[model samples]
Target: MRPAHVIAAAGAVIASLSLLSACGKDDAAGGKSGAIAVTATDSSCEVGAKSGAAGATTFKVTNKGSQVNELEILAPDGKIVSERENIGPGTGAEITVSLSAGTYKVLCSAGMTGRGPSQTFTVTGKGKATDPRLDAAVASYRIYIGEQVDDTLAKTKKFAASVKKGDMAGAKAEFAPSRFGWEAIEPVAESFGDIDPKVDTREADLEKNQKWTGWHQIEKALWKTGSLKGEGPYADDLVNEIGILKQRVGTASITATSMANGAKELLDEVATGKITGEEDTFSHTDLSDFKANVDGAQKAFELLKPVVQERDAALTSDLTDEFAKVQKLLTKYEKGDGYVSYDTVGKSQRKELSDEVNALAEPLSKLAGVVAK
Candidate 1:
């Protein structure tokens, strides 16, 4: 979170993450052992070894930089394999990732600047096959994804019935909590390709001539225009597409790395959408979505915490403390079971919230790397 002019929500986020991880041979991706040590300073990234086998390589990173720095593993396609963000000077962190046989870049930046030096590491051997334990964990996560879809579908159906009955007040009341189920599983929801945008597209994200037909579209009609007439079809289409997602996610495979990165990404979602007040602009229910996104991300981290603690107890403790701080800060905005409207949050308050979220996110960014098989 950087200081901006603090304008009103742009009312849109650029949402095309069309391209979007591993621990073991039996771990998350495939398994091998050997740490690729890295030293970072203001000027350079030094990787200890230039080449190794393709699975379970740990990057033991020491930030000798003049200030805090970040280290990232970029895949050949440029997607982040994993990363460690905001590491303070004289501090060190380890990121273990399962790698396939290929060339990859180990990049680092001092003071969080864009410009940085990088070292190339080559994986010379094949990845090991998946371990049964990793297989079961992935299976369990898929089951959890399925459960959320079921819950979301149930909530959205009730929401749909309210819309179809032309009960604007009832539909408005259901808006925040109903969206919770969807937000809680957004990491997985986002994977169904077109379904996520279709289900939640804000009017700002609509194509030049494309019609809007999701929650935000209906939100505009309900809260801005104060009408739900002719909105039933949007409701129907939303739930039907969710059903499609449910069926698809049931057979989908999830990995430990995905869950960890998804957790980090979810918090990023809050930092971008909620802290900035760019979501639910008309209904001002951004706070509810904000909470739901944190819930989803935290759930994923909680699942991987056991493994993280096994690797680094100190980092786990830091994460625990930061998460509690963020949760406590968010609780202040609650008025019983609901939150105050987003419009009521002033710029300074938003800055405070943004700072707490960034605090949480900095420690959280290390999670995916630590848990890599």
Candidate 2:
């Protein structure tokens, strides 16, 4: 199964959705700093600096492989520290982070599947970063997530009603919009532990007897099997599950670390899944997922922009421009409220989408560290 650019809660890659810019070096404190270059080929991961004095360090990653590559910084326990995704062949992205001395892993997913490569990256510093103003920003973003969750639940009800009523055309129309809220706030959703799996887990992640449920399950019935005879009960379960999530997310404890990383993770979802046409295999609504991920990430970025601007105006400007570029590209795919199905796109055009999305991911990957600082 495809892994993350659009997904990261614990390991590998899972994402929901890019940009490029010349970001300036650290202006805060430059104690021991250097660029650890990460290069990815079709079959392997290449890392330049494996060890560093770690108050703050930079990883300059370039993808030399054919597929879109996402470079991840992982804690020894496997939680993602930071990542940059949608990095297409011949393109690059970078991130600078302040860290406590510890062992870490540099991960790259080349084929967007089975672990592409991993290497030890040891940080040898005891220094710490001063906490930025994250409380209010994170709170605001949580509120945003809650709002999106509510919308997801509401729209899902509409979708389920259509499905239960056997209005396949109407139900199909509602499917993409119903997922927007969940995709935007998935990392947060995944934070709920079991609830996420229950609501969105696909056959790929479950054991044969795990009793798969949620949107993807319903997705398969509609698109893959083209059968709705026994789908009404499943549709009802989805609505109920989202309703449960809506209640829980309202009071969830969301942190800047998660929200910032959540933005990157959502993009990872798009890079690894939607872009590859491996997600939504039935309806081909991958473009719809792609847009939601971007929208979700953009909201997070917008909320945190004030803090980032104060830190570095140039980097913020570059990110702003990159978002616009990606948005313009998405506009080309827009048809009414949704986009044309992923299968409708041609090979050359798919490459174009890949490039633009990758361009967005490069700059998009830096969000976590900038705001977390």
Candidate 3:
């Protein structure tokens, strides 16, 4: 999903700290000294330097545009390696990514329309050696992603079968459950840059004249119309696209920093879409997506907990407490199998949930800094 401008205030502090810390580093090794400056404007994305050493490199992004812009680093194959989204006009944000030796592209999407100016960025030298604990975090997260893809594909197939048979009740019963796996590993799925829009685009995100084909299309049919009529082709497309997502999983490049950033991004997903009940509009299944996002974010945090504990014990404690609080709050709304419809949730209740998410999001935003250290 294309998210709204939702950078938490707490993240700005960390971005400054990261910039300060990088200033003291030795850049003697080819663009490794300090945070690289990336200036994003209405029509251009300009990099301060053309190359950097292969390691955890921070881009100090300043939005010089009049609209909200996003900074993205794309790999040679065009997969998004890391991105900082929803950067408002005249505001700045930072994204730290661990890069390997390769040629990459740095893009700034003006207004978050997925189009903007780009500059070629090259990483030189073998990447700096990383801590074993960080390496372990990446390995464990990769395993988790693979498992999620496997389970999501399986559930999606069952949902598709029900749709193919024109069994509206069964498909509705399976819809939210089928989406849990996808929501859990969404960051990984979204990195592909191609498959995510095909499978997960919401009605609001559709461009002019673009065909609507995805889970939401089927969902609208199931809940709003109470029929699966003429929906079989879209169902088949979903399954096939999900199958492609499974195949593309192995090709994704991730790092310990990427995992941390992705965790924060998951919370952003919750704040912008799931919390607003915009994700599953027709089905009112936003809480399921919300819980899955939290699940995925917490899993990433848990995998990196040892490293985080070793680096900043207080941050770890804060994260743990906040995650528990949010989970406990979510539990109150649970029905027998799934959550109560989001539309039934009162404004005050929604505010409570939003508050918990914002609280959790604060400490979680610092995760990339901790892991990168």
Output the number of the lDDT-best candidate: 3
lDDT of 3 by residue, 1-373 (tens): 3733323322332233222222222322224537788878989998888998988888877777787677888998888888877676666777788899999999999867667899999999997689998898889889999999999999999999999999988998899999999899888898887788888988878887989898999999998888888999999999999999888898898989899988988887787677777789999999999999999999999999998999999999999999999999999989989999999999899878888887888788788987887
Listed per model in order, the count of residue pairs whose N, CA or C atoms clash below 3 Å is 9, 25, 1
lDDT of each: 0.71, 0.71, 0.83
Q: By TM-score, who's the top model here?
A: 3
Q: Write down the lDDT that model 3 would get.
A: 0.83
Which has the higher lDDT value, candidate number 1 or candidate number 3?
3
Tens digits of per-residue lDDT, candidate 2, 46-162, equal 777668875656777777777767676666655555555556566666666555678888888775543568888888867555445665777788778878998999999999998
Per-residue lDDT of 309 in model 1: 82
Model 1 over residues 1-373: C-alpha lDDT tens digits? 1111111131122111110111223222222435666888878999888888866777777777666566777666555566655455665665666778788889887754333799888887777775554556566677777788888888888888998998988888888877897888776676453676678766655545767787888888888888788888899998899889878776443567767767876775686578777778898989999888888877777766767787889889988888888788889899767798989999898878777776777778677667664
Badly placed stretches (over 4 Å) of model 2 are 1-133
Which is better, 2 or 3, measured by TM-score?
3
Question: Looking at model 3, which ten-residue stretch has the lowest summed lDDT?
Answer: 16-25
**Positional deviation of residue 225's Cα in model 1 after best superposition, in angstroms:** 1.6
Which runs of model 1 end up more than 4 angstroms from their true locations? 1-137
